[model samples]
Target: MTLNWQCIVVDCDDPRQLAAWWAELLGWRLTHAGDDESVLEPAEGSPQDGVSPDMLFVKVPEGKAAKNRLHMDLRPDDQAAEVARAEALGATRVDLGRPDDASWVTMADPEGNEFCILRAFTPEELATLE
Candidate 1:
């Protein structure tokens, strides 16, 4: 048997808004926007365009009551700068009691969806993993 992963469905109060926010944050293309659902995809012709899964935001009446069981982990070239940019885009830092020296920073989107920003590996660190 074989399977294909199509998209990750996100439940939000406003699908359009949340989808737009994520599209901007990840630089993904917004392929569809409607009242009940919105979708985002990797840029056309990019390596991940068809290879990566899409994000599908769907409207839901209930609010998020707890931390997400599954979340995204993003690694950027500069951790601090990326975190700052996320804040500028309305994402807030979340302290989930992780240790101070933790390699990842927790954050929440405008609709309180939690995701992590992992620290980038230094050149020396990358070489060690090779």
Candidate 2:
């Protein structure tokens, strides 16, 4: 038996809008768009082509009421720049009482789903791991 991850589904009030926002942020293409859901996948031939799972944004009736049990943590080449870009695209910083020196910054999407932006690994630090 084998199981492969397909996609991460996110519940939002407006699937199209939310999906568009994410698509813009991640440079993913909108593979499908419908009344209730929108799907995004990395562009063909890109580094993330098959390794990264698709993102499916589905419409829901109720607004987000609590913190997300499962959230995404992104490691970018430049954490501060990425966070700023996300903010410019309508994402807001979220405070979960983390330490001031925490290596990750918590942020929420337009619909309030939380995700974190982790600090970039220095080349020397990455080399040591290998």
Candidate 3:
């Protein structure tokens, strides 16, 4: 049997604040919270079939330094719009050495956690994934 993906834990100085940032960005609901931890699940009718991993932000004393070892890539319906919206919400564009014609933009969340915003894929293009 294959194991299911449950959650992605993010390390931050303030879990609640980071959780709120992600919840608003992804339109996810806050599922649980504690003094040093917070959890968020995908919104109703989101791509989750009850199996999508939730996002968990946990408190840590250390601040983010150097580049991220792992990062998320987001495919939005309108890349530019989403980028603008996220920027308004404290996200920032980052230089990751991407080529000018690259279909994605690197960004950092409020806590300087890097993630990418990729152009939406067409069905035909997606079919090639399999």
Per-candidate TM-scores read: 0.93, 0.94, 0.89
TM-score of 1: 0.93
> Stretches of candidate 1 above 4 Å error?
124-130
Q: What value of lDDT does candidate 3 attain over all alpha carbons?
A: 0.91
Q: What are the RMSDs of all candidates, in order?
A: 1.6, 1.4, 2.1
Ranking by TM-score: 2, 1, 3
Candidate 2 residues 29-125, lDDT tens each?
A: 9998887999999988898999999999999999999999999999999999999999999999999888988999999999999999999999999
- Extract clashing residue pairs from model 3: none
Residue 97 accuracy (lDDT) in model 1: 90
lDDT of 2: 0.94
Query: Which structure among the candidates has the greatest TM-score?
Result: 2
List, residue by residue over 1-130, the lDDT tens digit for candidate 1.
Answer: 9999999999999999999999989989999999899999998999789999999999999999999999999988899999999999999999889898899999999999999999999999889979
What TM-score does candidate 2 reach?
0.94
TM-score: which is higher, 1 or 3?
1
What lDDT does each candidate get? Answer: 0.95, 0.94, 0.91
